[model samples]
Target: MSTFFRSSLRSFATTAKSAHHNNHRDNHKFLPPTSFLGSWEAPKDPKEAEAKLAQLRRDYAKQVKELRKEYIEEMELMRLEKQRKDEARREALRVATEERKRLKAQEAEIRAQQRNIEQQQFRETLLKERAEKLEYWRRKVKMHEEKKAEKNELLRRQSSMWVDEAEIEKQILDTVIATTHF
Candidate 1:
């Protein structure tokens, strides 16, 4: 049979047995109502009932003590498990935080390297521009020197023409003076 059916059959059997016992006890005429029903009463001998009640109380106390001990043990186990889980969670968070810090530092280093490269490129560009400017100035100076030399040549030719004209005039004046004297 299934477990549910078996348990129900056992419960029915126990109830039937308890009913039969009650019927037998009820048929007795000499016993008082309270004694037949197994309830508390002012017994003819009170000391025996008191002792039985005390023993039952002790048994109940022992069962309660055992239950309390089991409960405390279960609670302690749960507390330790919770603490272990908390520690693992804290360690995971710590590792994640360290990883984030490391990534940020790496990114900062990359950015710094990029800045340095840019600065170096800028310096090179500035040097190239200065070299171009100096080349332009050198070409301009060369052109000016060539023009100055050309002007000096022109002046030398003009002075030579003036000297020839003066020599011719001096010769004509000597010829006129000699003719008048003859």
Candidate 2:
């Protein structure tokens, strides 16, 4: 395992050195960014190498923690925005439903009022028809009474017997009472 690791590091160092030399020769304006991992080498002193490794580990851990905290804060803000939108949508829906109900109730009231008006008009028409029928009957009765009175006067004159107004009124009253019994 140690041999494999050393071989890999040697190859990486050789590649980096070649790239660096090429950059200088070409007079490049910019060099490629270096990674911390590629810069690390095994020190001759084991203790110094261990200390260096530990420091690098600490830096990497701190960077990871900071990124995680930022991600959590951004997620919390997004969640709050979503919740606010949902609440607004629900409120709008509730208001719309209430408005629909109000309109329906108003329409029902209008229909009821129209029905009442129609019923009243129908009743008035029936009363008018009844009044017309009663008037017709009254005219017919008056004509019959006039004819009976003329007949009675003619009969009395023929008999040479004159009936007084009180007697005529009594006879008319009796005729009215007799007709009412039927």
Candidate 3:
């Protein structure tokens, strides 16, 4: 059977038994536990009764003192245990804080190094591009000079081939005279 069903069954059985017992209890008289001491004697005289009462009072006072002493000792032990636990907790927190700080410091240092490396690489790339541009400009200037020089040489050769008008006439007369002599 399910636990709930079994428990309900047991509860019902106990209720039935209690009902039967209650019926039987009509013939029996019950006393409260508080009013039932182990055994008692009635003192015949007032003096004896007074003495008995005093002894009982003293015994209860002693028992109360012993119980209070034990309670105080137990409280002291508990206080010491609590103090020790608190100290351990504080120490653990301190150690964990230090470890976190150390880890953060290491991470910061690595980040700084990474930034430095990136900066250096960027600078190197910029310098290399600038050098390449400078070399390209220098080669362009050299090529322009070579072209200028070649053009000047061609112009000089063309000027040497030209003659004045007077020189051309004299050359034609000399040619006619030479043809007549032949």
Candidate 4:
């Protein structure tokens, strides 16, 4: 594993050196003034190399720490955003459900009112019909009573006429008998 890591690092260094050389060749005239002069030299001794490696390690550690902090902060921000969106969605759904229920309740109330109105109208219609029927029956009864009164008056007149005729006949018979006896 150590040999593999060393080989990989060597390959990365060779690639980075070739890329740098290519860029330097491509834009030689646009190079910075500082690039004209070499600022640092390679360490010679083992102690110097060790010190440089230690410094590089320290710098790498600081960069990794900063990167980790930034990554953690970004992840936390994303989580908070997701939570806020979820809460907003939940609230929206709750409001929609409540609105639907309110509308349904209002519809039910309207239907109830309509039913009440219909029932009242039906009752009124029935009352009016009953009143009309009662009036018709009263008129019929009055007509029947008038007819009965007229029949009774006719019967009474006929009976009185018969009595008067019988009295007249008896007087006439008595007169004839008196004349015969004389």
Candidate 5:
């Protein structure tokens, strides 16, 4: 397992080195911008190598801490921006909804007014039709009364006349009492 790990690490290091030499931006996240060794070469002495390795470890740790803090600050700013945008969107939606409601209410009022006008017109029309019908019936009643009067006059003239071989006469119709027998 150790051999496998070491081999993988060696391959990663070679690839990183080559990518760096080629100035490839793809490996920039994995590799630190500043060299931790600071141009130091490996010493033949084991004690010197151990000291250098410890120093490299401290430098790597410090870089990671700084990067983590910067990342946290950027994430906080991003979160604040998202919250502000959400609040603005909500406010816009509320305003738009209020405007829509106001317009809808106004439209309803207009419709009610129109309905009132139509109802008033309908009432006026109904009254006019009723008056026309009443006038027609009044004329019919007057004509009926005139016909009945003519018939009564003819009957009065016929009733007062005496049928005789020598004379035909009609008396004036003065009262209804004289025209009937009790």
Candidate 6:
């Protein structure tokens, strides 16, 4: 029973395939299009079919070898490109580090120069103040000496103007006694 059923199904599929092809042939009336289903039928000449299958296998193997070689070459190129990019990145970082060091040194030098200038200015200012103080003390000492000398000169003049009244009266008595004796 199963064999009978399968045979009928196969005949029905063949009839359907023939009908479909007939319909397209009647419409276009050209050669049928190549398809997987159409190519699935066994060839009438077994030797020719085997030769075609062997040729197809050879072509497929050649295409696969070519694709694999291309893939390996592409991978090598990608690796070289990655290495170049890495080197570029390292060079940029090195340059940036050197620039930072240079800027830091320049800033330190500027700060040192500013400190020296400030110290020099402070020393000059201190010297100027000391000189002014010495001048003021010298003027004060000279004024004091001048005042003391003026006071001593006034005392000498007053003593020289003074006279003795007792000496003058004795001189007058002696002169009168001498005239009476004459």
Q: In candidate 4, which residue pairs get closer than 3 Å at backbone N, Cα or C atoms, i.e. clash?
A: none
lDDT of 4 by residue, 1-182 (tens): 99999999999999999999998998877645884257446789989988977987897799999999999999999999999999999999999999999999999999999999999999999999999999999999999999999999999888877757678889889989989999
Evaluation by TM-score, superior candidate among 2 and 3: 3
The whole-model C-alpha lDDT of candidate 3 against the native structure comes to 0.92
Better of 2 and 6 by lDDT: 2
Clashing pairs in 3: none
**Mind sharing the TM-score for model 6?**
0.47
Q: Give the per-residue Cα lDDT of candidate 6 at 157.
A: 81
Candidate 2 residue lDDT tens string, 1-182: 99999999999999999999998989967766877647878799989998998998898899999999999999999999999999999999999999999999999999999999999999999999999999999999999999999998898788677667899899999999999999
RMSD of 2: 18.2
TM-score of each: 0.60, 0.59, 0.61, 0.64, 0.57, 0.47
Candidate models: Cα lDDT each: 0.90, 0.93, 0.92, 0.92, 0.87, 0.86
Model 2 bad stretches (over 4 Å): 1-37, 161-182
lDDT of 1 by residue, 1-182 (tens): 69999999999999999999999998977944564355556557779878878977897899999999999999999999999999999999999999999999999999999999999999999999999999999999988998998888888887777657678888788889989899
- Pick the winner on TM-score between candidates 1 and 5: 1
- Give residue 168's error in model 4 in angstroms: 9.9
**Which pairs clash inside model 5?**
none
**Which candidate, 2 or 5, has the higher TM-score?**
2
What TM-score should be assigned to candidate 3? 0.61
In model 1, what lDDT does residue 132 have?
99
Query: What's the CA error at residue 115 for candidate 5, in Å?
Result: 2.2
Cα lDDT of model 5 by residue, 32-115, tens digit: 667534677879999999998899889889999999999999999999999999999999999999999999999999999999
Write one digit per residue (lDDT tens) for candidate 3, span 6-85. 99999999999999999899868787677438555888999999998899889889999999999999999999999999
Best by TM-score: 4
In model 3, where is the ten-residue run with the lowest total lDDT?
31-40
